[model samples]
Structures are given as C-alpha cells and as structure tokens.
Target: MLIVTGYVQVEPTELAQFCNEFSALATATRRRSGNLSYSAAVDDPQDGRLLVVEQWEDQASLSAHLEAADTVAFVDRWRGRMLGNIEKYDASNKRGLMD
Candidate 1:
C-alpha cells in the first residue's frame, strides 16, 4: 500500500472557500477505484493550514489519482492561492504492531 501525507496552506480569508472546495474533492477521491482512504484536516484554522492524509492500493492507484482531471483542476486553481509550497511525503506500508 502507499501512504501520502501533506499540508497546504491558504490565506486566512480563503479558508472557508478552500474547505468547501476540498470537501467536494475529497468525496470524489474517496469514491475512486483503488482508493483506500482520503481525508483532510484543518491544522490551524487561523493560519489556514490544512493537512491531507491518504492511502492507496499502490503506486498505480496514486498515479491515476494525480492524473485525474478534477484533481488537476483543483490543484491548478488552488496553486496560486497557496500561502507556500505544499509539503508531501510518499511512503510504503510497513509491518506494524497491530498488523
């Protein structure tokens, strides 16, 4: 499995609109094939920092998601609105105590 974690920051004034847009995107992403899970959390509402965590079946699934038109459009639209660069980590699943 593939896990992805990231944060995107926006202007405080654009927080509400960004959340609204992300809500729709998250819903669509979760419904896609090969998607294990997808979610967004508000790290600091006042700072407009948003955190994203996602799981996928594999690299292929992640790649498909990245190429999705809606995903591309969302990124393009929000790129300029971002307060800074989006930080991301791509990781592979490893044995855990629960597993």
Candidate 2:
C-alpha cells in the first residue's frame, strides 16, 4: 500500500475556490478501486493551508491516478494558484501501519 500526504498553501482570498475544486476531485479519487481514501482538510479557520491524506493499493496504482484526468486537471490548474510550496510524502505498507 502507499500513503501520500500532500500539502498546499493558497492565498487567503482564494481558498474557497481551491477547496471547491479539490473536494470534487478528491471525491472522484476515492471512487477508484485502487484508492483506499482521498481525504483533505484545512489547517484552521481562515487558514489557506490544505492537507491531503491519500491511500492507494500500490505505486502503480498511484501512478495510474497521476494520469487520471481529474488528477491531471487538478495538478495543472491548482498548482498555479497555490501559495508558497506543495509538499509530498510516501509511506510503504509497513510504515503505514502506524497510521
């Protein structure tokens, strides 16, 4: 299994639009067979930070998701709107046990 954590910072004024689109893509991501989950949350009230907790069956499965239309679109469109940085992390099956 693979666990991917993604962090995105948005402009305070642009957070609402960012969340609207991200939430839709996350919903579709969770519907995929290889997807264990695709959940996201903001850091705090009025904060522009967003964190995504994603789980997939394996590396190949996650790669497939990377090619998915929704995923691709989200990457292309939202990337420019993002603030400072976007962070990513991967955890293998054994490491994921702690989750």
Candidate 3:
C-alpha cells in the first residue's frame, strides 16, 4: 500500500474558498480507480493549517492519480493558495501488532 501525508497552510481569510476547492478535488480523487482513501483535515483553523492523508493500492495507482487531469488542474488552481510539502510512504499490511 501507499500512504501519503502532508499539511498545507493558507491565509485564514481564504480557508473557506480553499476548502471548497479541496473538497471538489478530494471527491473526484476518491472515485478514481485504485484509490483506497483520501481525506483532508483542518489542523489549525486559526492558522489556516490543513492536513492531508491518502492511501492507494500501489505506486502505479498513486502515479496515475497524480497524472490525472483533475489532479493537475487542482494543483494549478491552488498553487499559490497554500504552502506545504507532501510525503509518501510504502507500507504493507502484515499481520502483526505494528501493522
């Protein structure tokens, strides 16, 4: 499985607009093939900080999602509206406590 996590910071005044755009993108993303889950949360509303979490079936699925037109468009639309970097992690569902 593939896991992605990150946080973005936007201007407090633009939180609502940013969230609207993010919601549209997230909804579309969740419908894509191979998508396991996609979500975003407000970490600090006063600071306009938001956290994102995503899970994919594999690297290929994640890559396809990244290359999707909607994904590209969303990035372009929100490029200057937020600040943060996303990181990805490779994981396996081993039958263990740590898993």
Candidate 4:
C-alpha cells in the first residue's frame, strides 16, 4: 500500500474555491479502481491550511491516479493558488525492507 500525508495553505478568501475543486478531485479519485482511501481536512480556520491523507493500492496505482483526467484538471486549474508548502510522505521503510 502507499500512504500520502501532506498539507497546504492558501488564502482564507480562496478557501471555498480550493475546497470546491479539491472535493471534486477527491471524490473522483476515491472512485478510481486503485484508490484505497482519500481525505482532505482544514486544520485551522484562520490559517486556511489544508491537509490531505491518502492511501493507494501501490505505487503504480498512485501514479495512475496522478495521471487521471480529474487530477490533471485540478492541477492545471489551481496549481498556483490552491497550495502553499505542500509536503508528501510515505512508508517505504515501514516494513524494514530497506534496513
């Protein structure tokens, strides 16, 4: 499985715009064949910070999802205004295979 944990910040006034697109993207992604789980949360009202948690069946699934049309639209539409300081993470070494 693949896990992605990350967060981003945007202008408070743009929250609705971000949520609209993000929610749509999340909905579409969750319905995909290889998507196991997906979620995006707003942690602070004043900060306008958004956090996303996602799980995929594997790296291939994640890559495929990234290439999906909806995802492409989301990125092309809001690549600049929707995110600030986004971070991505995974558990590649969790099973100790790298050790």
Using lDDT as the measure, the top candidate is: 3
Report, for every candidate in turn, its global Cα lDDT versus the true structure: 0.85, 0.78, 0.90, 0.80
Residue 21: error of model 2 in Å? 0.3
TM-score for every candidate vs. truth? Answer: 0.84, 0.79, 0.89, 0.81
Could you tell which candidate, 2 or 4, scores higher by lDDT? 4
> In terms of TM-score, how similar is model 4 to the real structure?
0.81
lDDT per residue (tens digit) for residues 9-96 in model 4 = 7788888788888888888888888788899899875878988888887888898988888888878877777665544456555555
Q: Where does candidate 4 clash, by residue pair?
A: none
Q: Which tens-of-lDDT digit does each residue in 1-97 have in candidate 1? A: 7778778899989999999998999999999999989988899999999888888887888889999999999989998788544444556646787
Ranking by lDDT: 3, 1, 4, 2
- Order by TM-score, highest first: 3, 1, 4, 2
Query: Which scores greater on lDDT, model 3 or model 4?
Result: 3
| Candidate 2 wrong stretches, greater than 4 Å | 45-47, 83-99
- Candidate 4 regions with alpha-carbon error over 4 angstroms: 84-99
Q: Looking at model 3, report the run of 10 residues with the lowest lDDT sum.
A: 90-99
RMSD for each model, in Å, please?
2.3, 2.9, 1.8, 4.1
Clashes of each: 0, 0, 0, 0
Worst 10 residues of 2 by lDDT: 84-93
